[model samples]
Structure formats: structure tokens, C-alpha cells
Target: MGRKEFYWYYKLHATTAIFPTRSDGKLSKYKHLGKAGSQTYIDAIEQITARTRIEALDRSIEALRQGLKDLVEETSKYNKE
Candidate 1:
């Protein structure tokens, strides 16, 4: 069989029989879709990328806030001198 056919065959047979509950109480079925070319794998990669971008932006905002606070403190000290 070709690679695509093999992937579908594997996916069909690799699924688990049990549906487990997630932390939010939603029922989720387990699928063995960790194969590199699958849609689910691609989605997971995108999610990770988005999360990383968000974290970097948050750090930048915090650094800017700290810089502003330091500038204000310096201004107040100079005015009092």
C-alpha cells in the first residue's frame, strides 16, 4: 500500500476503545494521530507557536512597565534635589 493508505489504515486501527473525560468534564476520544503529516499534528504545532508568541509579548509588556516606573522615580528624585 502507498503511504497515504497506510496512514489511514493505521489511524483506523490505532484508536483507543475508551472515551475518557477531560479536566473540564468533556468526553474526549484518544486517537493516535501523532504522525507528522496529520492534521491534528499540524494543529498542535500551531497551538504551541501561538502560546510561545503570547508569552514573548507578555514579557515585553512587563519590561516596558518596569522601564516607565524607573523613569518616573528618576524624575521625582531630580525634582526634589
Candidate 2:
């Protein structure tokens, strides 16, 4: 198994309900049936990374939204006074 095969298997599993991902993020037993088991433990750090990027992005978006809201409210108050 190689990086290419693992990616292919990953894509295949994502498309179909055949091979399931385990709680540990590894492929299920059925994955070996396709002969991709050899690359199960391998990872691809070049093209992808699984970390807190999504969480950080969400927090940034929320902060921006709240800041915009606060600005709008303060401007409206100043206009009235």
C-alpha cells in the first residue's frame, strides 16, 4: 500500500458505505478486502492535516460577526445622541 492507494481507498470509503472508519480513524476490517490494508497505518501530511483549523476558523468568524454587530449598535447610538 502506498499514499496513492490510501487516498484512493479513503475516497472510495467516503463515497460508499462499504468500508467504515473506526473510532481510531483507521479503516475497518473490510478495507483489507480490497488489498489496501498494507497502507492502513500510513498518513499523508503533505497535502492534508487534521487539527483545530476548523475550530479556529469558526471562532474567528464568530468574533468578526460580534464586532460588526457592536459597531452597528454604537454607531446608531451616537447618531441618536
Candidate 3:
């Protein structure tokens, strides 16, 4: 999801779950599902980190390919002599 969508969804669920209403239509005190909420945030962060790592890895692989191509061309030139 995009930036705005993410914030909306996070706020929506947080509000609904933390402030559930009573039978008489009274809103209860906000209760945090502490560890679970923490875990959710941790998991989201890990996902973002994983994406960053993957992109970095892809760039490194491309760099390696270019370096290897240069090396191979140099070796071929030496063999031609």
C-alpha cells in the first residue's frame, strides 16, 4: 500500500480493536494488545528491511557482472597475443 493507505489502515484497525464499544453504546477505554502490536510493527519493519536488502543485492550482482565482463575481455586480449 501507499503512504496514505498504510496510515489509514493502521489507524482504522487500531481504533476499532482498541476502543471497542459496549452493548449500551459506550466506548471502552483504549486497550493495547501490547506484544502483538509490537510484533506487528517489528514485522512491518523487517519486511521493509528485507526489500532494501534485496535491492542492494541486485545492484551488487549487476556490478559483479560488469566487473567479470571486463576481466574476461582483458584475459581474451592477453590470449590473442
Candidate 4:
């Protein structure tokens, strides 16, 4: 997908979280991480990383399949002659 499409996709499905506020009523810098830290943040990071790796593997598999298909066609043509 293009940048704009991916941006909208995430924007539509993104989760919302409320963080603790400061004395002045400003939002915390570590909004997602939370005050004392959170397992959710770690899990989210891991999940995203795993998804990226899976996508890379899927692309690699498709490329390999295409290469093998091309090689088979070439070999068949050579044998016919």
C-alpha cells in the first residue's frame, strides 16, 4: 500500500490509551509506556516486529516461487528442441 493508505489504515484501527497527567495538567511524555512501565508496551513492540518479519518472509517466498516457475518453463522449452 502507499504511504497515505497505510496511514489511514492504522489511524482507523489504532487503539487509544490514557496516561497519567502531570501537576500542570499536561499529558505525560511516556504516554504509552505508562508511569511504572507496562507489559502491553513490550508486547505491542514485539508483535509489530514479528509482523514485519513475517511480511518479509512472505515476499521472499513469493519471489522464490516465481523464480522456480520461470526456471521450469525454460527447462521445458530446452528439452522440446
lDDT of each: 0.68, 0.56, 0.65, 0.63
Worst 10 residues of 4 by lDDT: 5-14
TM-score, per-candidate, Cα-based: 0.61, 0.42, 0.49, 0.55
Tens digits of per-residue lDDT for model 4, 1-81: 556542111111234433445566654434343322356556656777999999999999999999999999999999999
Q: Given candidate 2, what's the lDDT at residue 81?
A: 100
Ranking by lDDT: 1, 3, 4, 2
Query: What does candidate 2's lDDT look like per residue over 9-55, in tens digits?
Result: 43322344445565666555344323334344243222234536667
Candidate 4: segments with Cα more than 4 A from true spot:
1-37
TM-score of 4: 0.55
Q: How close to the true structure is residue 74 of candidate 4, measured as C-alpha lDDT?
A: 100
Identify the candidate with maximal lDDT. 1
For candidate 1, the lDDT comes to 0.68
Error of 4 at 27 (Å): 24
Best-first order by TM-score: 1, 4, 3, 2
lDDT of 3 by residue, 21-79 (tens): 54565555543333435775567557669999999999999999999999999999999
Task: Count backbone overlaps in model 3.
Answer: 0
| Cα-based lDDT at residue 32, candidate 3 | 30
lDDT of 4 at 12: 13
